[model samples]
Target: MTNQQLLTKPIGIDVNQVADSSSEEATKAESSKPELNSDEGLPLLLKAIIEGFVDGVLILTTNQEWFHANECGRRMCSQISQGKLPINSIPEPIWRVCQSLIDSREWFSDRKRFLEDEIKVNKSVEFRVRVRWLTLDLSRDPYLLVTLEDQHQSTKNSAITDVINYGLSQREQEVWLLKKANFTYEEIAHQLYISINTVKKHLKKIYAKQKQLMQH
Candidate 1:
């Protein structure tokens, strides 16, 4: 796909809107239970907020136990866990990273520590996992929020696959994929180890090809 087309394509989730709504709901939940600042109350606040996120979300305790899983999270776990309970269904690679974060003192000391990694569910499916430390309430301890996104799902509607199907060059397809992922021009150039001008040149060719295909 052309860089412009990729940029303009809808990705189906408005993250800012979700964040705003979640924050507002959390505020209301907090006000209702002013003294309930433990992990018990924290999940209630998070549940309302995270339900709006497209990603699969899991709230984990300090000991790595699962406190809650959103609907998307539960669905993802069912696919990966092969009938295991959602609480015990964390994939090993993801679990290992979660364990390390839980064990690290830095996670507790640094209030804003964020960890991200990419894991393959199979040869076809891959997910980007993000772990962030959150202090939902000052009266209670912090918790780990794990978010998962199916990387392939995000690009399914974009022109990455179309570029490949249309017999575009490998470099062109790579550029399309990165652009579809919302990479800036400079970021795409850096990732592909090409000059910005080269990236622009690629996009021009891609745009022409896409236009040509559309005409037919």
Candidate 2:
């Protein structure tokens, strides 16, 4: 969780190693309620990688109990819960998908299943939610992996895609993102740790690229 930590390490989960280490009975019992604490149950490296994800990642039991959630996941859960602090429970709208998935699993237990839903806050704001079963052991029940994506951030990403298509350089793309967010030149410079004149230079180049794209 610090800059001193390097993220270049390859991450992999050895399911065979984990499964071989535990007894069948233990795996079966633990599968009924797997440990959600990343510190105790998951590798520190895996936890760090999950935390670094832009989208929210949540793991929940079939009974809808809280298991583990990355930071973005918790934030989205709070937002869905209407700014409720200490999101120890799942939101009703999201839980509906889980409930549906669980009920459907009764009829099709052998197949991998996933469900999707969207939560609308208003006309302009919404979150895309997807839920699916995550199985660690063959003999155990699968936990639910719910991914939450913010539509607002998705819109920003789409805009960035357009900036890329317009042939903006990497620095120009960064400058354009801040500019699109309505940051002043001084603010953009401060945010990027660059001189104000450099910000203007980037903007000037960005505008030229946009103009050229329009002409084409």
Candidate 3:
């Protein structure tokens, strides 16, 4: 359905009417008239528009505080939360993710996926977010359209293959031997005078190579 149709039908709000009217008119059409502190079903059409979208909709306050969220969005947030994340409640990880997004709009728009680094929800879920920038109203407030999707099996398999392709360098092998001898990557990095991320990258390469060889 069209965005207007969805909003007008589910939330029962007249977007055009609200568009022509004041922000107060638009607020009146929302469920519970939240900002105005009044209670009522948000215009059916508006509600439907959000709920029907493939992406989860989360409305945040001007202060960047959580205001409300749709079902899919709510579930996505809860999955990563390790517990229920009620309305208005924010998790630190999510907060960090949002901050990073706001900090790097370009990076935020194009999320990079790494092998075995797929963001997991709760424990073992592989989650990816497709986001779009949104401006809600006359106030020109900023919001985001975040779509939660599961990676295809082929994608995951390909990632493993890619990691294997970039397998360990000679210096990495030296670190791996020490790691096998119970040295932490940090300790190895310290001894090798390398950064922790570099050490981890090397180990990832080592791990993928070992898996590849074993498969052969």
Candidate 4:
């Protein structure tokens, strides 16, 4: 089906369309980019796109067989499995969510196409698992696109990105991270082995840098 036809459906964003759009944008940015052979190249492009994601991306068959998983996805699977399962196997916790989605598809038909579940290993570690149907061909059974997001890791990554964008100093970045984690001024000072006055000073500078960046 054409992208227009695919968009007309309620199946959420089309991965193929995203890949195509991204490729077009890249080509515009770099006119000298070599052309890709449509059939084989598209799948490779899709895999590359998935690999670039910060969150874990897994494309699996209905029976839970792994069709494709990026490096982040593999690492997360190992974490969820506690390094006990084979490298290619999906962790039981994640598979449970995928199975629930599969069951929903079978019993409720198209009533549900997306499902999300949060699995917590402890107070500080958790994964936001999202499963959705991915239909590449109308004639074939739809596959599952499972994304595993490490909540803590994602938060830290966002904070780090902001630190760079705002041009935070080394000391200011350390203070900023502690502050973002909900640490009290005193706690931040203790963690950084500095006086509370020093902690406040770093935060003031960090805020000023962020404000300056935002105004531009």
Give the per-residue Cα lDDT of candidate 4 at 65.
85
Q: Mind giving the per-residue lDDT tens digits that candidate 1 earns over 78-187?
A: 66655555454666666766666666555354443556777766744677777766554432566677888877776755565677656679899888877777688999
Better of 2 and 4 by lDDT: 4
Off by over 4 Å in 1: 1-46, 84-88, 106-108, 160-216
Q: Residue by residue across 1-216, what tens digits does model 4's lDDT show?
A: 111111123244233322235877766645643344364332556667888998999978887788778899999888888789987998988888888777765666763457778877765678888887776532267778889999888778888998889888899889888787667999888988999999988888888888898899
* Candidate 2, number of clashes: 0
Kindly provide the TM-score of model 2 when superposed on the true structure, using C-alpha atoms.
0.60
TM-score of each: 0.53, 0.60, 0.41, 0.66
lDDT of each: 0.66, 0.74, 0.53, 0.75
Worst 10 residues of 3 by lDDT: 1-10
TM-score of 1: 0.53
Candidate whose TM-score is highest: 4
| lDDT comparison, 3 vs 4, better candidate | 4
Residue by residue across 1-216, what tens digits does model 3's lDDT show? 111101111111222233325677667655443233223234455666768865456654435676556787787667667676665565554454444445554543333311111355532355564333444442345554345554433354554454446465678656765565456868889989999999888888777777877798
Order the candidates by lDDT, highest first — what do you get? 4, 2, 1, 3
Clashes of 1: 0
Return model 3's CA RMSD, one decimal.
Answer: 14.4
Which residue runs does candidate 4 get wrong by more than 4 Å? 1-42, 106-108, 122-125, 182-187, 208-216
Q: What are the root-mean-square deviations of the candidates from the true structure over C-alphas?
A: 12.9, 11.0, 14.4, 9.2
Winning candidate number (lDDT): 4
